[model samples]
Target chain A: MDIAISLPIKDETLLPKLTIGDKIRVNGELFLFRDQVHKKIAENDTDQLDSINFLGSGVYYCAPTPVKEGFLIGSFGPTSSYRMDKYTEYVLKLGFKVMIGKGYRSDDIALLCKKYNAIYVITYGGCGALLNQYVKEVKLLAYQNLGTEAMQRVLVKDFPGYVAIDTFGNKLWK
Target chain B: MRQISCELFSNTLKSLLFETQYFIPEDVLENIKECYINESDSISRDVLNNILQNAKLSAATKLPLCQDTGIPQIFLELGSYVYLNFNLEKTVKNVVNIVYNEEKLRSSCVSDPLIRKNNLHCYSLHVDIVDNESLKVSVLIRGGGSENMSKTEMLLPGTTADEIKNFIVDNVINMLPYTCAPVIVGVGIGGTFEQSSLLAKKALLRNIGQRNQEKFYSMLEDMIKQNVNLKGCGALGLGGRVSVLDVFIETKPTHIATLPVSIVLQCHSVRKASKVI
Candidate 1:
């Protein structure tokens, strides 16, 4: 079944709604971070990273090109999730309800998603041009020197993704 | 002997970078379309369609095909008789800096591995001299994903064909969706450690559908392709029959005691372009 989800991922209410192989389109708030941001956050406290107080939010692993004159964001796509596997457990424990990226997740991440009642999504890799269509607004958040790897808060509408790992421990890929 | 100024050469490099990043080359597009048509799995089919759509949108919008415009690699096959007016390497870097700024591409290169400072003046260059008088310049925009998945192995002189096949298949399984399969696999065999790896990277610069000139290596390329696709890693590694579009092998004579092998992966968004000066 296909489901449309809004930002600020609420309580465990939406946990049972998605299953492995389910199609989903997300709308609302998403935080963009890549390897550097994840590493920095892992070394620091969650409070230092917790400027935005949202219940359950999605975090996208992306490093986007610079936005041209009039565009909201440049071509953006999910990077491989496994590279950030080391810091995922630390970040997920902090109330982030969902993770968005391409490729397979580490076993530990899948297990954590099940335990924390969170989800992992897979967007098509290298489809940055098509993916940018969903992004409505982008605002810089932190780490300006990191360039594309800097954290940004984005507002997206109908961002297409597939549920790779659900809260029930079911996974789309082995 | 023909003479070309550095300014004209840099201008060519600038446009090639812009063209390749935003538009999928004709040969690569045809191969992907063929794979999409032959693929039976719905998931892979949908992903393939999306890939093609992304290419079209990028061209129409005049935006980069992928956000990771990556580190630009410029390969120059210069003629021994040709004359150059300026420093080739410096000219390349200057052109890249200007083009990067004008195009608004991402600066993904890190200056030092440990400190991780972004290097805005990064370019991977290889220059070779051919016997002819004209110069040929080729640019490859390599993304970080497939480049990270690339591997190199040095084996004993007595290693068998079966061993080579198994090693490659194993690596493919390990990379899975991360390498962004339906990739072009380039294999370099028989050179020294560093040369073998360079050969593997250079092999990816070949035109799609181009085959190894030697029959023995060409057959090995065919064998590797069959085995890789048999794994069914498919497009995005979700699942499909066509895991690899092509496999290229470049070989050089090596010492009798060592057999070096290297694999370089190029994802489906293969961006390669060339110009003759």
Candidate 2:
């Protein structure tokens, strides 16, 4: 059978139809962050959050290296999603439909994904150099105090990621 | 006697930092290329291609190969014959600051683990002095993905070599895809707990694809590589032929009652550089 699907599937009705081997290519603006940025967000530091409007988009747990000249970012790869489990529900509440990272998530976040129509995606963990090319432009968001963990607004095109956790609570790994 | 100025240390360190960021070490690059050629899965092969292209662009453009330019770690072998010149810590800090600001590398380091504020951007540096006139420094730009997967355990004295191998193989299997498979495994055995962990990290500083000098250790490395690849972790843990590029083990004699082992994984982007001055 042949089929085509449009991504950023905000509607929950479409989640259950996804299968294990299904490949998804998401097109949306992304927000980049890591441990420090997540901590700041949990602490209610909205100063950096103001720079980005992630109301209905995705957030990538990443700490990218910088480029030499005429480049926006460097070796931007996914960090472990398990570390962000504590903040997943909160970010989902703030209106992010997609969470992209690597590794598995906690049960709490899995449950929240079911409650709220959101999907968690996983990318190759160490493929940073390849992943950076997907980022079209990067705008600093907040948490300059957090260095690489600071939040930034990033534009992506056909960003490749797999649905690790779906809205219906289906885990690709488990 | 050679009198080394603080300025000299800072300059050399900065150059090493920049060079490591720009050029992927020849051996590591070669291993990844080999994986690309041997990879059976189409998707994995394509992913490896993308990774190779990224390395090319990073090197030619003089950009950091991967973001997480890692903590500013320096393994220094200071020469005893050299006369004092300047403070080592300050020189390292200066080089770190220059790299952080000038190169725009992400400031991944923080002041405290608990408070977790990005007050400092330099990662921790480990220094050691040896009896020599020329200082040898090895810089490793470790990425978070593989570092996070490190594990340690204190085994009973009765634990056999088979047990050690099983422990390592199990951990590698469990961390597949998560730690970015096709990893380089470094094992530190027989030292104290902390010493074992440090030895494991130091093992990562070895040239990629090189074997340990001890015949038994070298044979162990070969066994580990074969077993891990058989796990089907493949490229990026998607399932393929080459799950691990290399495995290196370093061991030292410990108390008869203790057998400590530490495992540190290095992803395909094994970025490291060394210089003796």
Candidate 3:
């Protein structure tokens, strides 16, 4: 069944309902943290990340471009998820219940998701312009100097995606 | 000798970069439309539909088709009879820097490959002075997704056609989910190791459905296409019969001792544009 899930879900309220291959529309605040942010967090320079409670939050592996005139954000879409797989365990261990990007994650990442009872969703990989429609607002939360790699909070509305890994550890990508 | 203005070169290259980077070419768009119609699975159809919608949205909003404008490579065929007033290389670099660094596009160039600094946008420039008087410039916007996921192998010179086909189809299937299928697969066979890789990358410039002139290679290309699609990686890796939009095979004579093959994957947004002066 198709599901519409709001982001920053608390505990496992909406996560367990998600199963691998389920097409879902997710909206609400998603923290845009990609490679650099993960590196900073690993380096212990938590900066603005520590102030936020990531428990049950969804992190998007996306980097933003310059906002065009009359738009809230640029063509911000999902990057390949595997590059960030190294940080998946760390992010999940820190209490993230949802993560989103494109393509398959490491098998270990799927197991970690099950261990944390979290879900991983896959969105259109390179369709940045179309994905931009779901983004309503954005705010920089940390690392503003990092250009597109900075951490930000983006509020999306009815963004379409698929559950790549469900809470039970079932995964879509083989 | 025909004299071409440096400003004309700079201007033409600038506009081509700006326009082609945003606009999905008609062939690619049409193929995507076909994929969308043919996609049987609901999820894969949604992904293809989103790609179609993205093309329209990109055209209307002036937003980039993809955020990673990718590494911009220029292939120039300079006519021997043509002369330029200024340094063509410097002008090309300047135009590329401006186009990629502009607000709409992402500055993806990691200047020092070892240092990994994204400051310098590398101009992968190739020049071939042709005998004709008409100068041509072509740009290939190689996205990181497909480029990074590509594979190159140096196989035994005795490798048979089936062996080559198996290697290609297998790798393309594995790369499909990651490289953002439905993609354009460019295969470079023969040539030296480096030349084979270059041939493969250049093969991506071939228009979709354009086949090799030789019957053997063209048939090999068709076979590779059928085999990869039969594996069914499909669009967005959602599982269907059209993962690969097209396969381009380019071959060159190589030393009898060594055989090289390169598989270059171009994502659905095969951003290629050209102009003749």
**Clash totals in order:** 1, 6, 0
**In terms of lDDT, which candidate is stronger, 1 or 3?**
1
Misplaced by over 4 Å in model 3 are none
Per-residue lDDT of model 1, residues B147-225, tens digit only: 8888888999899988987887677667767866678988888889988988988898887889999887788888888
Worst 10 residues of 2 chain B by lDDT: B115-124
Candidate number with greatest DockQ: 1
lDDT of 1: 0.85
Model 3: residue B142 alpha-carbon error in angstroms? 1.4
- Models 1 onward score TM values of 0.97, 0.88, 0.97
Judge candidate 3 at residue B156 and give its lDDT. Answer: 95
lDDT of 2: 0.75
Q: What local distance difference test score does each model get?
A: 0.85, 0.75, 0.83
For model 2 the local lDDT of residue B93 reads: 80
| Model 1 lDDT, residue B168, Cα | 74
Can you rank all candidates by lDDT, best first? 1, 3, 2
| Each candidate's DockQ | 0.77, 0.49, 0.67
